[model samples]
Structure formats: structure tokens, C-alpha cells
Target: MIPWDLIKGGMRHHISEHMIICRPVSENTYFVLRLTLSYLSTQLTWEEM
Candidate 1:
């Protein structure tokens, strides 16, 4: 299982960085972003464990 605290901090940093690079996202882009984030979170959690 992943630790909540670590995910929150790291996720925030990643999101901020992403926002800086891509400020305007369309519907398809949003869907892709969601999928990417989900994949990233799962990978990060696994790596943490």
C-alpha cells in the first residue's frame, strides 16, 4: 500500500510543474492527463513500497 502523505506532497509538486508547462488543456488532453496521473501514481506507489 502507498503512503498518503508522501503521495500528496509529490503529487502537488508534479502538478505544479505540469501546470507551468501546460496551462490550457482541452477535453481529450484532460482525459489523457487523468490517465497519465493515474499511471504515475500507481507506479510511484509501487516504487515506494
Candidate 2:
């Protein structure tokens, strides 16, 4: 799982709601990251089972 603290720390240093929404590329990257994390967690769960 991606740590909220790490995400928040990165955001604190170099991102904002405005920047995230304003840039198309950044928005895509964010979505990809979300999807990848979700997929990874699901796979991990299946492996445990």
C-alpha cells in the first residue's frame, strides 16, 4: 500500500489540487498510480489466498 504520509509529504513539497487538475499529464499519472496500486493490492490478496 502506498503510504498516505509519503503521498502527503510529496504533495506538500511539490503539488496542489490546482496543479493536479490543471495539467492533463499529471492527472493521467495520478490515475495510473491509483489503478496500479489497486491492482497490486488485489493481486497480493489473491496470492495470500
Question: Which one is best on lDDT?
Answer: 1
Alpha carbon deviation, residue 18, candidate 2 (Å) = 8.8
Backbone collision count in every prediction? 0, 0
Q: Write the per-residue lDDT of candidate 2 for residues 1-49, one digit (tens) a residue.
A: 9799998988776756655667968777887899999999999999999
Can you write out model 1's per-residue Cα lDDT over 1-49, one digit (the tens) per residue? 8899999999988887776677746645786889999999999999999
Q: Model 1 Cα RMSD, Å?
A: 10.3
Q: What pairs collide in candidate 2?
A: none
| Candidate 2 Cα misplacement greater than 4 A, ranges | 1-21
What local lDDT does model 1 show for residue 35?
100
What TM-score does structure 2 among the candidates reach?
0.54
Give the TM-score comparing model 1 with the true structure, all chains together. Answer: 0.46
